[model samples]
Target: MKRFALIFLFTFLLSPKIYSQRCGGGILTFNIYTLNGEDIKEFDYEIFPVSKELLQKNLYEKVVNEQNMNNSDYPLFKSVETSGRIIGKVFVDQIIDNNNPKLNAKLQELLDTSAITQKGTITSTLLFSTRENQSFPIVLKISNGDREVYILGNYFGNCDREASLVWGDKVLKLE
Candidate 1:
């Protein structure tokens, strides 16, 4: 019984560190708001660390599917290229190494809401290429990097569902 208790305690103590190591060096949150500026819902989207190549491939596939290309077209090609440039270029490092033991404290600071919203030293900005009309407005927050950069994006209802980053908070505007 004593041995079992010791093992349990050890696991409990080590789990947080183990879990933190798996973090993809970034976090995203979605906030939903009404037209009147009332917050309706908020949730976290667990973004996985991925290589730039993988992100490009995924973005290409997403554009292809959404455009429903029956034939090769210049417009479609341009759209795909633009989307890749916007998202892929902006995030120079898609998968940050949060597992670095030296950066543990920094990662924790990056994940802190107050630190990000108020005291964050890094300049935060929102960048998106395509604009679409929607019934409701969605807000997305992305936190990443050792120095921590936050990205805010406005998602237009169903149109952005396919392109929106999965690991972050997603706020959907309700009709």
Candidate 2:
């Protein structure tokens, strides 16, 4: 009885840490827009929680293995850590407009079927520019799902070219 109780306690204690080692959770929707407020890209991303194990793996793959550097060398890859433990695998969706009749119809149908309300909601905006010299901003709004929201934005600054959003001492950049 004593051994069984010890094993059970140990297992329970370690379960959360073990499971949180990789990304897995809910879907995050990111709506990307031009600086002029034109919606250009919409993506639904699978959110994952970042752990120390994940950080080590990413550093090894991108830095040590890919760049052929020693572990003691400066990191060649960057990692974003959020106050929350969720990262997303971004999946691009087809661009559509609110003015599009077909899309409007579909949206109305969804609204009719779903009992969605924006009571407890959080929104994060990330502004960035692409290699094409196009400047844009993305708005990420999360509601009625996970308790925490994670969003990262990266881009060169228009004025200084070194400005970045700092959250909890972590610099967020577009992946």
- TM-scores, one per candidate: 0.22, 0.22
Error of 2 at 162 (Å): 9.7
1, model 1: CA deviation in Å?
88
Candidate 1 local lDDT, 35-132, one digit each (tens): 44433243332222233343335443555665454453645443332221124334434433335554444333333422333222222222222223
Stretches of candidate 2 above 4 Å error? 1-34, 39-48, 62-120, 124-175
- Please give the distance, in angstroms, between residue 113's alpha carbon in candidate 1 and its true position after superposition: 12
lDDT of 2 by residue, 29-124 (tens): 223222334332332322122222334454334335644544333323222211111234331111113344654454344323323221222233
RMSD to the hidden true structure, all candidates? 19.6, 16.1
* Model 2: how far residue 99 lies from native, Å: 43
